[model samples]
Target: MTQRVPHVLVVGGGYVGLYTAYGLRRAARKGRVRVTVVDPRSAMTYQPFLSEAAAGSIEPRHVVVPLRTVLSGCDVITGRVTGLDHGRRTATITPTEGAAYDVGYDHVVLALGSVSRTLPIPGLAENAIGFHQVEEAIALGNQVIDRLDVAASQRDSTLRTAALTFVVVGAGYAGVEAFAELEDMARDATRHYPTIEPSDLRWVLVEASDRILPEVSDSLGRYALAQLERRALEVRLDTRLVSCVDGHVVLTDGTELDADTIVWTAGVRAHPDLVGTGLQLDTLGRVVCEPTLAVAGCRHAWAAGDNAAVPDLTGEDGALCSPSAQHAVRQAKVLARNILRAIDAEPLQSYRHRHVGSVASLGLHRGVAELYGVRVKGWPAWLLHRSYHMSRIPTFNRKLRVVLDWTMAMFFRREVSSLGSLQRPAEEFRRAASSTAPRAS
Candidate 1:
């Protein structure tokens, strides 16, 4: 008699999906279960290191883990999970450059991550960029450097000032770190341009809330605000961006400016696929899951990471776990273990881990951290930030590469060249071909 191997379909190859699939690969090899990981992206991005990559502290390639390289024993599908029917135990998959199809599974893990939440502010969607993915980080670096090029070459003061001005919205870890890192890079690069002065570049951070870095204590947040202000950055609190029409910014506080660069990092909501999954969700549209990380009203279905609202046992109140990389990574471990137990008909354990403190890097040799009730600021915090994230960056290959990048950076100046043209490689060729073509008779 032949044994039947269970099929588990894991959605979204981000943190949770990658880790879960990686963990189950051994079991999959032994024929206990067959695992398939589905995502639109072929690689899992380590988002914590995105800001550093943008700042040239670490190479972008080192921050993302290729799914096929890491998950050796599992099937890695480069496709999007468009719809889920838990009752029917099937998922609708739409592959890039292929026909849509359904995949059957005995168990399903919905690790679909979140997307940026944007408001209806005028001209936002058309004008601003996001800071979530590797491509965006790369584009941001190119954009900043290209802006500097424009500032250096343009004799028009209005256009030059607009080119030099950079605006970053939201002051969370992503917002603050991105703003600081890019500004630091731009400031450093100014030495090479005789026409561009360091003081000529204007970096502004705007947050609608009264405070920044709300994950940290109020005092620490105040300290970060002061540090940024010391660098001559304009920190706008209690203000809203009313419009950004044609790069002309109008704030609620009657402030107006023209900036060629605008970055949005306000917040994120769960992937909209949750609504179509027909799963129970909280008010915020995150899947409601039990402590064991199982979907609230379904068997053979589980969820974790940013998409699931798991109860925070550490909070001691009715609070749910905060959507963060810390919780997502930890929950993936627990989620993998429980799935194995379920296959073996063993008892499952609950996911309960206290929230650790937060850390943020403000450019090279500067950071702020609150860890285990101990607050550290300045250079020490920056070192700790790098060390902690380096330790958490996934594979040994990537870890070694990141260390090599840091070690090499110590001996050489950071690369600040603008490769923005890579975003549109065919433009030059198209222009040349058009110019050489014969006119219509």
Candidate 2:
């Protein structure tokens, strides 16, 4: 008689899902276990390099790893897991088109990552864009360049000032890097426009907290503040974006400015889809997990990354692991191994790792890093930032491409041209079709 093979369904294709499947690739290739990954996006983005990609320091394609290419041994489904019934070991998938369907699995990994945490600030949803995905980053880059074009050609001083101003809300890693990198890119871009100067551009970084880069040390944060101010960029700490209606920005500090670009990088919340899973979630809506990275009290269910509240064995009691790539990547290895061990009837090992320090880039040739109790800043930190992320981003193919991009960038200038037509690809066709339409007499 033939034995039935266990099917492992991995939800979400971010760091956790990708690395977990990659870790289990050998077992999958040997027919020991069947693995399937499902997500809305077919590619997994290396978020740390997004700022560089937006700033044209790296090609956008190089920052994203196509799941089918990396997880060749696993089934890749481009859809969302709309519902989960662990009691029946089934998940409902809703594809981009067609009807929804259910798939049965012996084991499931809930790796649903986080989404941008937004507030109810008036006109925010309509006016600002989030900096959490590859598409958003690319659009933002194009928007900045397009604004430069608008600023250079506008006749009215108020309209020109509005077009030249850029605002970023939230000063976390995403916001700070985006703020600095985009500013640097725009400053360099002014050289191409004879009508625009570096001084003509206005960059603003708004944070509700009292300091920027809260992930790093206070000293490093202060240094980052100094660096940004030196570049003539505005840093507003302990301030909130009160409103941004029609490109008119009103801040909590009573300062108002006209800005055509507004970026929201506040923070992230656990994926909202967890409610449909019927799994136990914490107060913050994250799935509750045991030390072994298994869903608490559930059979053959596991979770990690931003959506799982896994106890941090290395931290003080009652503390859960933070949602960061460093922890997510490390947690995935353990999660994969434990799943294989469960199939073999072996004891599962607990997940535990001490928190390492943080690193962040402040545009080209400048950064801040704290590694193993050693603090570094400036060019050394920048190099460390690039080197660390380079070693961490998945796949030799992507790594090689990224290296080539940097190699080419060393001898050539970054591309500043904006392809704004990408935002409206059918506009030209629609216009041409309308022009040639037969007149009704």
Return the top candidate by lDDT. Answer: 2
lDDT tens string, model 1, 101-172? 999999899999999989998889989999999999999998998999988899999999999999999989
For candidate 2, what is the lDDT? Answer: 0.95
* Least well predicted 10-residue stretch by lDDT in candidate 2: 350-359
| Candidate 1 TM-score over all chains jointly | 0.99
Global lDDT scores for all candidate models: 0.93, 0.95
TM-score of each: 0.99, 0.99
Number of backbone clashes in candidate 2: 0
Question: Model 2: per-residue lDDT, tens digit, 1-441?
Answer: 989889999999999999999999899999999999999999999999999999999999999999999998899999999989999999999997889999999999999899999999888999999999999999999999999999889999999999999999999999999999999999999999999999999999999999999999999999999999999999999999999988799999999999999999999999999988999999999999999999999989999999999999989989999899999999999999999999999999999998888999999999999998899999999999999999999999998999999999999999999988988999999999999999999
Q: Which stretches of candidate 2 lie over 4 Å from their true place?
A: none
